[model samples]
Target: MGTYKQQSHVVWQCNYHIVLCPKYRFRVLTGLVKDLVEHDIKMLCQWKDCEVEELSVQPDHIHLLVSIPPKVSISELMGLLKGKLAIKLFKSYPQLKQKPYWGNHFWSRGYFVNTIGLNEDMIRRYVLHQEEEDKKEETNGKHFTLFD
Candidate 1:
């Protein structure tokens, strides 16, 4: 269940369902790479004072249901998360620059975001079960497995 947050003159429960994919829809998210991505996402959310109610990282994309404060715009938050994650990933794995990938780009230029209104419970359930539902066959010899 989501809780209301009280500000100076507002009480809110602003939650959103956000989905993002890798650049060119590449299947590079697996094994250690997946772990790092998930960790970085949690760290970033915490830094932004946002709360992640549920998260699922697939082989090519990610699903997150998060509670954000009224003061922050969705685009600003998304940009920060995506930008910082790319920087960290690139730094941690310089070999990714060799082939099959290029430049400073990581995530795709666009994302899918929806506000959690009356369907908050339904959205939460969907996000929670996304891992099992989004499971894909191993690609590039990298097995797809769920990581906390």
Candidate 2:
């Protein structure tokens, strides 16, 4: 067998973002997200014991930059964020208990998460700029993904 690669305490810094469907965009999901998750959003930053570096909620999607420990995987972290919020929100409000809430789940199945390698500023700008670009695209009547 080949020698095993040594592992270090790798700080997994990542930027996560995702959007909702256009129909529901009319519902002002962003506003609702802020109202429904204002306090909880802070809590979510620490989901899975991960440290939240920044949090930005846009009109359609959310921008979450966090550094996760090696003990937890990115998918697991996302699950925790989406799961915890959905459970609490669904329990609190009956309106979101409706169908296809974020594609049969609390959050949209596919999300954009970028792994930080170098020049963190570039990555940060990309994450933040995505909100503006997406809004412009939506305003221009550009089509959304199939989920939309």
Candidate 3:
């Protein structure tokens, strides 16, 4: 559980469950790639004064429970996370650029987010099982897009 943060005139708990995937749902998040993503996310959260309560990096997607400050908007935070990760990933693994993604974009256009309140436990469980749940889904040899 995140401790209450005291900002100018308010005491608040701003926690969220955020999930996102790579462009075209590519299963590239493995081995060193997975380690890089995890490290980058932790560093980003530390830089932004946020707390990462839980994190799961699946082959095709990422699930995170984070506590962001009240001063930041979810969209702004997501933009920073996605944008920075893309840049880092591209630089660290140049071969990734050869993949079929438009304008060097490494992630999809949108993401999934939910607020965490009293149901933090439930959210934690969900994040933990993300990989298992995804593996159970029958894609029928077809790729799925979140935006679709």
Number of backbone-clashing residue pairs for each candidate, in the order shown: 0, 0, 0
- Whichever of 1 and 3 has more lDDT, that candidate is 3
lDDT of predicted model 3: 0.89
A best-first ranking of the candidates according to their lDDT comes to 3, 1, 2
| Cand. 1 Cα-lDDT | 0.87
Query: Cα lDDT for residue 98, model 1?
Result: 63
Ranked by TM-score, top first: 1, 3, 2
Compared with the true structure, what per-residue lDDT tens digits does model 1 show for residues 1-148?
Answer: 3578888899999999999999988988899999998988898898888898898999999999999988888998999989998988899998777678867898899999998866768889999987765554343434645872
Which residue pairs clash in candidate 3? none
Write candidate 2's Cα lDDT for 1-148 as tens digits.
Answer: 1112223744344443432232344343566656676567667756466666666666566676666656777777766667787777667765665664443355555667776445679879999999999999989989567776
- Among these predictions, the greatest lDDT belongs to 3
Evaluate all candidate structures by whole-model CA lDDT and list the values in order: 0.87, 0.60, 0.89
Deviating ranges (above 4 Å) for candidate 3: 100-103, 119-148
Error of 2 at 47 (Å): 4.7
Largest TM-score belongs to which candidate?
1
Lowest lDDT sum, 10 consecutive residues, model 1, at 133-142
